[model samples]
Target: MAKDKKYRKKKLGSYPLASVVFSVTLALFVMGLFGLLIITTQNLTQLIQENIEVQVFLQKNLSENEVVKITKILSSKDYVNKKAGVPQLALITKEEAAETFIAETGEDFVEFLGDNPLRDVITVKISPDFQATENLAEIKKEIGFIRGVYEVTYIENLVHSINKNVKKISYVLIGFTVILLFTVVILINNTIKLALFSQRFLIRSMQLVGATSSFIRKPFLSRASMFGLTSGVLASALLWGLLQLVSSEVEGMMELLHLEQLLILGGSLLLVGLLVGFMSTFAAIKKYMKMSLDELY
Candidate 1:
């Protein structure tokens, strides 16, 4: 009976299991929240970048064949955006442009001018990497020089402003991420250390009974690693639930959620949890092992 009781105590260890699990879960939850924020911000930035369009005005009276040829040339350029293996370039006829303008402004400009003055335009959405102001100016000049092209224009000021703001946002997010990562490491480390504090006597007892340091640390590390994995899984589930709730409540949110990015974030959290748990457990065991009996008391 006495030996069985001792065995059970050793198997359970001396850590506060519930407290450790809760603490680790809370830390991972905060980290996952920040990960979601970063992913959503990237998606939002991409959406804005994709909306920046450049108008390629063609020379007036170009035949249908010429217009088709111009579109093919523009689509082949490296600067253009591509989705699903196709270039995001659309050709708009002068008549269609005029009709759209009239419908938007609620004015019959065609009646006043007695002719369509708008040129057939190829609306090009540039790749996000090439949306810089200088790159755009070079692109405009290059496209303007293309045969059968009349003018190449875009909202230059808007593009410059977007780039400037995006740079600032990126800097801010980077700083925040660094600080958050540091905080998370410290928090998890402290939690694991505290949990191990109650096990100091057990560790010392095993050491005194001819147990190697690795033997003494093995079970504690294993339990801590399990704690980490469990906490990470719980945190990820909570994050997914929160996202699903938000998507259901908010219109257009489903469009912003990237499942691939979310999966990567979840996997990263699990790995971080395992790493921090094992390292912290190992450190704590080493510290307790080095302490004299008087200090441990």
Candidate 2:
């Protein structure tokens, strides 16, 4: 009787606690990685959209007052990008345009033609929400109608291509995200279920001794919840360390990391870990409790 009781005690105490924690932490870490990728993709998209600029060519020989008036009008429009509470509008003089062209092309067209053919321009950066191709077309038409405006032009093909590629990339990322989340849930569930398998006979003995279902479940549920919470914290800490390492090693990576989104992702990982651990443990215990004594063999 003493040997049998000692063996049971050993069995109950020897549950693979380290393996369970390691498995849960690994699963949570993978999910966190996917979350970071999604956040980075969104930040990249916003950066690209914000960089899209529209060039407004002014008619040659406009008076200084007319130029000032046109700039003020463009600046006041809602379609223009605003940064630091200032409109993203800049005036490029004909001489400045000529210099830029000469520097880029390595040929002085003004000197060759004996005249500067470049027009004064006002470059306006469109807000991200208005950076779509169709919206840009409408903006160009509206601005082209203004008096003293020679033309409104931009890189139409570039914008269209970027929009098309970004759409495809977004679709791929979303699909990958869904698949990864499903995988994480399954992996975590299986890990917890297997961990509880060793406790089945112990649970059965408790049931045979007249322990209430709630009483039997309470200890297991509490431990599983703690396991999950600890795993999540460990996983999150590792992820944060990884982020810091990447940001320090890779140029421009910090620009793409969104703090608010990352915080939300970390919280979500913790919630997922806690729920999966608790539910899997409860299910496993219930299954053992319902089995006959002979089933324990």
Candidate 3:
């Protein structure tokens, strides 16, 4: 009798499980792809913001000490980008600017006009958190107040466009993610229901032999959890494979899609799979548990 019970327990949750895992895995992989795209967009936004340089032109005829003072002030600001504990600020002296202009335009303006019209400038890359239009304007106002600073300037239109487009993209992607989640739930529920159809009679036989409802649900739920976990792992594996293919075919792809971020995405997928799988299985089993013998036929 004990052996028979063990056999029944094994058979109840083990057969036809492959189809459930495949269906859930495919759904999760699709969702994972979209998740990857969303994170990529975020990364691109940061990269663009890092390149948005704010040029701080200095006052004319300033002494070396004054120039050093201005540089120190700008470097101390919170908005300035940093790398490895060093501020990313560059000073382009008027002499270097004239050389660059002469090289580019094929005309030595300083030699022609007897003066270098270009001003010495300090350029700073603003952090992404301060890349908003209003934030940049405030930064310009604050930096312009610094002594020996002539003018603070940046591409205002570019900043506005980035802020606007980021909002729009976030809204669109979030909407799509929510819609896909709902669709996946339906797909998983339907797939699990059909898979459980063949087991309806076995479930009824268990009940006829005085099995309780919770007892009957145990094996199915246990198997559902297992299938959910397997599906999540398989889905994550497929996503990793896709990333590998992309990184091989496309240069610098890994820079935008980082491995550390994968942990959050993978955890989300595992959670979704387990939650949806377990709930759908419970619901399907309840329906069978409530049905009469004729309904099984």
Candidate 4:
């Protein structure tokens, strides 16, 4: 009984360095990947929100009142999710439009023409979610049906191309993450198995001395759970440190890790680390518990 207790304590104490390295490395790897996922989603959302442009070219002879009425109709579409959906209609007056053209081209062509040939154009900034050609096509058809709209100009092919590329990149990243996760699990399993190898003899000795398999396995299970908990805490700390460095120095890189949410994410990561340790330990012990004394040699 005394020998068994000493043996369990000795086993737990023997592999501190290896366990620390394994826990820290695994935590950093997973946390880095998770951070990447967060950044991608945020940047994509921003890009989508900013890139929708829908142009409504008004008829050359429309009155100012008619132009204002058309602008109101375009602004009221429910699909424009006030916040993340469709942006407000921006009215570009003919004089401002002419000035823009002059500034852009540096040509005095409008002066040569002697009249403002440009009509009032309403610019619609759609949200990224509704930037698809099909959605734009429907919007175009609806607006074109209006009496005073001469044309609705939007580049459908470009939006389609961007969406397709984003989807492909997302799929590739997802696949790589799954593969890396599996590889980490296996690596941790092997590390734990090596750490627990010395206990095989102790387990057999306990069994031979009239100890039930459950009694013999209990001490190892408890030790495993303890190791798992400790490792989980260590891993979470390492991840938190990494995040802190990024947030402080990277400047506008990881604003998502602001104080409150960062604390929550760290707490969640600690739980995850603990689970990884516990499960890996349980699995390693279960394999040994099934081994016969003859197999220990």
Candidate 5:
């Protein structure tokens, strides 16, 4: 029983129960959290970009035929956003615009000026792909060329600000992800190395008994892989729990979180865990296998 216990302990690298598993699971969980942040940020950016609208003010007193033609032309353009095959464009007649103005300010502008000065405006939301300043400028020029169209206008400064800030945020997230990846690799590597430090004597004993490197490495590698897989599963569960809690507390976050993306991130964690575990264990085993007795002591 004593010898059997000793052998089993040796096989485990003499690691304290749960130490290696806990360390690996914590690292994977942190990485998963960061991945969720990146995904949410991207979704929010796209949502904001899609909401931007451009105003197309029409020439006064256009006939019904002319107005219908303008609507059809704008709707046919590739840049216009659509939902359920209907273009995301709305027409506000001069009278409606005046009514809205008066409702908001409690002043009847038509009564004050004796004539409504508001022109008919058609507001169309452009697709997220064309929200940039240059793209909006091109779109405005194209819309202006249509007959009976007075002018096309949008918030130039707002568009520029959104594009600029999105680029900045993207760069920062990418840089942080790279750094986190490097850190996680080192963290997992050192963790495995520390766990195997106690197994030096056992490895040397196996080596003295004429055991081949592959024979000695098989059990250690297998257990390391198991530990990695367990850690990955635990990490994924934690991530899912976090997502659920956040979505419940924060409105609209559920829509931002995508199942496909979460699945991919979870898969990536499993892959990272297995690869790192196998490689780190192999390196640690090889180091102990080559160490002299004096060094082992």
Candidate 6:
């Protein structure tokens, strides 16, 4: 019977170590998942931003000098930051525009025209943030009102739809992140509790020996804090590894994940681990504190 009791004591003594390992592993997994979410959303945003375009039709009578002037004016606008702070404007000369249409339709009517009927067109790429259909329409109206612009064509409906869809996707991502966070908290709490459980009897024994509740709680809190700190480091390491792997396969992804963002993410994970470990330790101690010796047996 004494040997059996000794074995039980040994098992209980090792519980905190096992719990700490479990908490750290779980934290690492959660951090990796959050990193993936950040990377994917950033890539999607960039892809959508690059696809928004605007086309400006020049007046039929406008000369090459006039077209160049308009291009310069448009390039100076504040919204041109979509592409390296330079406006994505392409000056399609009348001849080139005609050739493009002819090539697309394979039309042989080049010889029948009195002159190149196509006007000089300036193509503009808009930023994704301004892609709301109504907003884009207002912008089109504004552009159309320009003195030399014959027409401004932008797919307002398409841009509005894209914005709406992107908003919905963002909401879904937020919901999933919340769920993931809660799941991580619960898993960490349980793992830490199991680790603290081993010390419950020791805590009770101390209580019988007239150890103050605060005194009994000190060692557990210290151990739990250590576990929390270690888990946070583990999470950070995991996040770094996952981001490295993702960067290897995707170009320009490092731009989205700045040091500030990574620090915020790591800080949150660490805070979570600390809170879980402390709360679990406190709860375990309280449970044993209120128990009778018979109850413990």
Total clashing residue pairs per candidate?
Answer: 0, 0, 0, 1, 0, 0
Candidate 5 has what TM-score? 0.89
- Summarize candidate 6's per-residue lDDT along 173-266 as a digit string, tens digits: 8888778777777777777766665666877767778989888788778777777878887877777887799899989878766687677778
Q: Which ten residues in a row have the lowest lDDT in candidate 3?
A: 8-17
| Candidate 3 residue pairs in backbone clash | none
Rank the models by lDDT, top first.
1, 5, 3, 2, 6, 4
lDDT of each candidate versus the true structure: 0.90, 0.88, 0.89, 0.69, 0.90, 0.75
Please, what are the lDDT tens digits per residue for candidate 3 over residues 116-188? Answer: 8888999999988888888899999999999888999998988899889989988998899889889988998
lDDT of 5 by residue, 207-241 (tens): 88898999889878988898889999999999999
User: lDDT at 258 for candidate 2?
Assistant: 71
Rate residue 228 of model 6 by lDDT: 80
For candidate 1, lDDT tens digit of each residue in 31-132?
Answer: 999998988898999999988989999999888898889898999999999999899999989889888999999999999989888899899999998999
Clashing pairs in 6: none
Query: Where is model 1 more than 4 Å wrong at Cα?
Result: 1-12
Per-candidate RMSD, Å: 1.9, 2.9, 3.2, 4.3, 2.4, 4.5
lDDT of 4 by residue, 1-297 (tens): 999977656653244455645654575447645755655465765666556677899998788899888888888875453555444678998899999999999987779999988878988877666766688788788889988999888777766777777777778777876776666666666666777787677666666788886676666556655665566566667766776687688776564435655566566555655566567767766777678777777
lDDT of 6 at 294: 87
Off by over 4 Å in 2: 1-14, 101-113
Question: What TM-score fits each model?
Answer: 0.94, 0.89, 0.89, 0.75, 0.89, 0.77
Global Cα lDDT for candidate 3: 0.89
